[model samples]
Target: MTMESATDAAPLRTQTVAVKSSFYLAMRILEPARRDAMYAIYAFCRAVDDIADDEGDRAQRREALDQWRYDLDELYAGRIRPRSAFLAGPVRRFGLDRADFEAIIDGMAMDVEEDICAPDWEKLELYCDRVASAVGRLSVRAFGLVDDGAKELPTAPKLLAYHLGRALQLTNILRDLDEDAARGRLYLPREALEEAGVSNHAPHAVLANPALDQVCAPVMSRAREHFEQADLVMAGLSKNAVKAPYLMAAGYRSILDGLTARGFAPPRAPVRMSRRKLVGALLRHAFL
Candidate 1:
């Protein structure tokens, strides 16, 4: 299919949804081709995520996810369907890993299979890797860190993906505690819950527990460490190479800082970067 068809295949609705996302600035700042590729990836992610979170029947959701996997298989086998045609160019041009795409599907499957609550640290990290770092792995290629047709990614980009992905995901977990609890989901590790003497894993009960802040302390600390590691990795890369990811890290770190300042106590106000702060981050990363 022609690039025009591929571009058109990326639904306008998905682009609109992506434009309203927190990573809008990060994706927007890329060069045209790279930005398009990133948007395609984001659209793919958003579609599957919606299915995973849908209140529909589990079997239908699983069937939907399976259809995506079939489409991916088609895309890889040089048979592009209208639904996934947009990804063909990026996948070929950037040498995007098929497994990374499948990992994302698998990650969504985790949610479909069960609502995760207080998983152990290893399981939590695996969840983070599948859902977040796998996306980062795909993104680093689109960002031009790994050359086209490269056999494998370099150590630094890989590490950057590993650290930044987990950093961002953990921050999300901390920031969305109340929202997730409202949906009967809790992402805090079981070890942390136990360490904090939180016995109940019921989402609302856990949220109402006075020791929630204690349970969150280790998670916050871990997120900070991952952000620090991401910073260290970014410092070693070319400034031009890391501009988008740097902005993402900066934006998310600001949110994490806001969360820390807001504290995990009851009545936690929703934390977000103001438009002015977002503009400041854009200017700083874009031109400075």
Candidate 2:
């Protein structure tokens, strides 16, 4: 299907939300069909995420997520709901994996099951894979990095999804430490917390601990390593093929740098990308 047709057929709400997202520009730089496909995927993700983050009863939220899973099954079975019809074109055109979509829903279920406290390293990795890497898997397909008729993803793009997904997610976990704590969640791995002398696993208590920065250091280092690995993988690909990933990496790396400079001390100043820096990244990664 043509980009214009696909985009116009998309739910208006999805279009609006995708346009408003921070990654809009990065997505916009893509060829039309890919860009529209990405918008659809982003919309799907945002809808599930909203359900997970809703302040309603947990059972109701889980039910809502289940509804999405049902919708996805129907979608794959050649049925499409009005709200999700946007995905039909992309799913068929890009050969988007059903498992990746299901993984995203599973990740949302994790959030809804309970407020995650200090989870073990394994659980944390699983969460990152489901929530972030799964999305990246879908996105890489949308980005046209996956080969047509290929049964599996190419090694480089798959690795790109793995490393970049974890990098972006870990950066998010570090940047949102205080915000997540407010919501009674803490994503820092228990191993890191224990190693840093943060005996209290309570969200707010851990955030208040002076050792919080100590815990964040290893996570930050891991993020940097992932970013570096993603960079190395992207380095071998054509720039056009990896433009969106490059832009995303640059933007998040900027945020990581800002977080590093700001530190995790209490009364923490918000770390945000300045307009100038954002523009620079856009020019460098998207237009250059």
CA lDDT, every prediction? 0.87, 0.87
Model 1: per-residue Cα lDDT over 103-128, one tens digit each: 99999998899888889999999999
Task: Give the range of the ten consecutive residues with the poorest summed lDDT in model 1.
Answer: 2-11
Per-model TM-score, in order, reads 0.95, 0.94
| lDDT, candidate 2, 1-288, per-residue tens | 332244455745566879977678778888888888888899999999999888789999999999999988778877677667788888878889989999999999999999988999899999999999999998898787887545699899899999999999999999888888888899999999999988989998988899989999989999999999999999988788888888888888988999999899898888865566667877776554
Our tally of clashes for model 2 stands at: 0
Superposition-based RMSD of candidate 1 using all C-alpha atoms, in angstroms: 1.8
Off by over 4 Å in 2: 1-7, 286-288
